[model samples]
Target: MGRVKVLGACPLDCPDACSWVVTVEDGKATGLRGNKDHPVTRGALCVKVNRYLEQVGSPDRLRYPLRRVGPKGSGRFERISWDEALDEIATRLTGIVAGFGAEAIWPFHGTGSLGYLQGLEGYPGRRMFNVLGASHHAATICSVAGGTGLRYTLGTSGGMDPEDFARSKLILLWGTNPLTSGHHLWKFVQDSGAYLVSIDPVRTKTSERCDEHIAPLPGTDAALALGLLHVIVSLGAQDERFIAEHTEGWPEFRDRITEFTPERTAAITGVPQEQIVALGERIARTRPTAIRASQGMQRHAGGGMALRVLACLPGVTGDWAIPGGGLHYSTSGHFRLDDAALVRDDLLPHPVRTLSMTRLGEALLETDDPPVKALFVIGANPVGSNPDQRRAIEGLSRDDLFTVVLEHFATDTVDYADIVLPATMQPEHLDVIAGYGHLYLVWNEPAVEPPGECLSTTETFRRLSHRLGLTEPALYDSDEELARQLLKGHDLDRLRADGFLKIQPGSVPADKLQFVSTRAELAGHDPLPDYTPPADKGDGLVLISAASHYFLNTSFGSNPELRRRAGDSTITLHPDDAAARDITDGAAVLVSNARGAFEAVAEVSDRVRPGVAATTKGRWAKFTDGATVNATIAERDSDYGGGAVFHDNRVEVRPR
Candidate 1:
């Protein structure tokens, strides 16, 4: 590979799965940048992804397999051959299965590497483990509540394209900081000349740029949505024609929201009554308004209900029928790939137990009947990402438990692993990527080979299956075959040539909706969402583990350059709250609740609401003095999707 240009896609889990152009020189990639022809990414990359070439070839990259040679969590290991590592893993897993049954073994992974082959819905690794009858991972840490709840009203999470934002007169930047997370889409919103409104508990970068910033109380988004509906109903602005043609439960829903008046909504949410009335009027009067809902708002106890209510707003204004309208949660459903072809669930010997990845601490420490004895961790760093961090670490420290991790760097989770295997990056692997924000479908091809003994996630699983004596043909499926399966309707040769293709193609907006008649996807689900109060509330302040601009949930935290720019994991508090507690700005403080505690430097400012405290989450323990926000975060599940309630954390803060 000498001075060759290679087309690829970003494998990180994000709305904008950007397409990239990699410059390979002397058998290694020298430069990586966004593809100018790509529509959503628009020849630009985020702060974390812009330095992709540097990150892939970092000095600290794990290049070979290693076995623990010191105490657990000591970050000590001895180099080992891939064959020996796989053999030992196979032997230990077999023993665990023989003694504790298949349910005792769990495969832990996340969207850190979200390529179609290596991402969420498995191409081979999932099939191999399903054949082996390992515990089913609910993989609900992110996107669960937003996807599940939006479907309850819209029947599908797919909606108007981010490009459609150019046609809108109004936009709601709800619960998301698109400036950092979806930077590409933010340009479309800005160019559209739309009146942007931001709704969040703190004054985020998106909020600061908005024409109106509505700071609602944490977990009170459902109530605020209901209040908007109340004002719309009172003004008789409901789209009756669209309602008569497409909706069913409008009357019942109308009656239910009579209780949530604007005044009541103002009381529930911290926003003023006048602002609620004004915002509701804008929503009712605005044409082709798009509600850009994010997953953070739904990280509360009532996360599911909030999205359900937000999903129904488009129906009231008939926004679903227009360009730059309707709610955009995720466009992942638009791919319509042959999942059965990629994931061979039929190979399972029988149905196995399902474990929620959000409850890893409980699964490891509390489960009695065949507790998780063997765990294979990949594509995630649970010690830094999962809730109840202390408890999860305590469980990982158990002598009888065996843990395996595959990675490019020694993450906090790798510190406790019995066997650590070297893993390949996107530039050195093959996979496909689809956007949750745009209509593009990208194919990521290998640009360069792994430098050392590093291997792809799919190859690692195939090798392990071979060593375990698993003889399923499905376990040996090729990457190209799975890629062909996903690109069934499209022209394969053209897709390969372009390196990207639009999954949803249409000249009209209605083309996205599968059900023109608005109704819940599942039976027994409330067609009309109700206003639910906060689950955890008190006189004490609420702490939200907000996402940092440079780091995506424990994925890019290992990058030293990115870490330097992110600064420390400091907490921000309202001046009133800080004054009441006598806490000084920039001083180290304890953010604690009944369940757990963590330390953070406090920044006393009025940017946050009086009753709320906010801090950037996903900092690794090593950078933060063996501390993280997850230490205090409860393992509470969302209302419906079994999602982790990361924002449902309530704590009292005081200077140390």
Candidate 2:
């Protein structure tokens, strides 16, 4: 046996961008640990990183490319050679383009694979589609709403570094559970001397550790933010000089927020008037107060407005000038990947149709003249992640549509695929990752040759490009070359030598008080964060879905150990609400809404508000009994950001 080979950079589709030192003997991975030298992750990793070997070596992993031998959505396929697979895909896509024009073909992808080659950067999918003049999807499924809202208020959503948490005097965890979803960030928060406050519909693991937990009604975040602003202004906390100098439309914004008194906000948000007043006072009293807002708050009908309102808090108090005070969102800046440069339109033969990622099912099933004849899916699980699983299934089940899925395992999406291409595991590929939550761009070297016939996404695309005669020499370059291209203006040599790179921090202008007055404000929108309730609020209990630490969508759900760790999907309800519905803890209950229904074990607790219910997302589709959480969520979105309103749904629960 030789010395174990440690691999850095294993893609888990997570924001951590974890660097792993894989202990290998005789070409077999023995164990894994976090690379202490990695800049972003430091020496830490979540529980998932340790269990990656099991996932990579799982028996369920796809070993070879396979073509469907039975009906679509049926898990029946026969193994095919790489040549045959590439040939088949190329032929089908060409025919689709020739007949329906380039717009008829759609490439659906996201953060499934963190490597630049597989995602938006290195892949030719978007380039080909764009060159072909295919309809381009806006592609803002996750953070678009928050991004839009923040853009309007602050010009950008960027905030303080996670490491700077140690400097904060007051930390407001709004609609996020860093303890679970953001484990590493939680460590910084724990060590920080900051007084922690958690606000959400449910008392998450994060809330449990907080100094105070405020359970607000779902979808009322904007109202609460307005109330807080009202308190801050009323208590004379506003930086009037800064507000007058830096911001635009201040008079109108001030006039607008004057009506959002604590009493008025209490009724709208379901938070006690005293709690609102106390929180407002805390914000006013605390120096360098920081607010951490996540996607949770932006998954409602008026979610974008909520984020905009929350972002205005720090600015209103001139908190953005402080090292640890500001509204924080995504950390995608730590590892910068310029997508526009990678997309070359000259390579494609025609224009392609655009599709909405949010309406994946509808797009797939649409019977337009040319139709969505062919689909190329990479690094995403639309069936599991998209809203309305039943509709997604029906769309994928279309007999005439040809589908290709590149994955390591048989996901819910794979069952409907016409061709399943085996994909290399993270440790088996050479890649680079930049976290959206922290500052670090870590390089990952392959620990072992790709097992069996599996290939990396880059290799797959390269082979397909060669077969299609797309004469672009750059498309066939090595991963290293591609990485270099992707990191064009960035310092690649420094990143390589240091094992990570941190970008220079940008500054928020000194005079800007809030969204309306800041240069960072988004175009075609009011500068101040505004709020209005959704048009529809159904009768009965409101449903909200949150992320699960154990699973990333349905990927890790197949793992028995991970499944054991996650346990069964349970519906969380307030004790009083459960009793009123004649339900008890541990009892099987039926959760139904206008869209669909599902059954699960009920847990009654005071952690949640009386009118609301909560459940973790990323459970296996089969466990929902044909009804997933997205089914109940309305497809309607915030007008400004186009964010899905997952938390605005109203459902009823009954004893099953």
- Backbone clashes per model, in order? 0, 30
lDDT of 1 at 38: 92
lDDT tens digits by residue: candidate 1, 312-403:
78877788778888788778766787777777777789998898999999999999688999988888899999988988999899888999
Regions more than 4 Å wrong, model 1: 505-527
Q: Assess every candidate by TM-score.
A: 0.96, 0.95
**Candidate 1 — worst ten consecutive residues by lDDT sum?**
507-516
Residue by residue across 1-656, what tens digits does model 2's lDDT show? 78675657756656567776888888888878887876546677777667888998999889999999988766899999998998998888888878877677677775677666666334446554554566666565687787767666665566667777778899999999887776777767776789999998899989999999998888788999899989999999987776766666677788878989999999898899999999899898888988888877887777777877887787678787678887778766334466555665555565444567777777777648567777777877877787767787888998888889988888778889999999888778877777767767777778887788998887887778778887666666787787787788888877766566777555543234355644324355555567767555778888888888888756686788988988877999998999988999999998887777777899998888899898977776755565667766655656555666777778899998
Model 2 C-alpha lDDT versus the unseen true structure: 0.76
lDDT of each: 0.84, 0.76
RMSD from true fold, candidate 1: 2.3
Give the candidate number with the greatest lDDT.
1
Q: How much is the lDDT of residue 86 in candidate 2?
A: 88
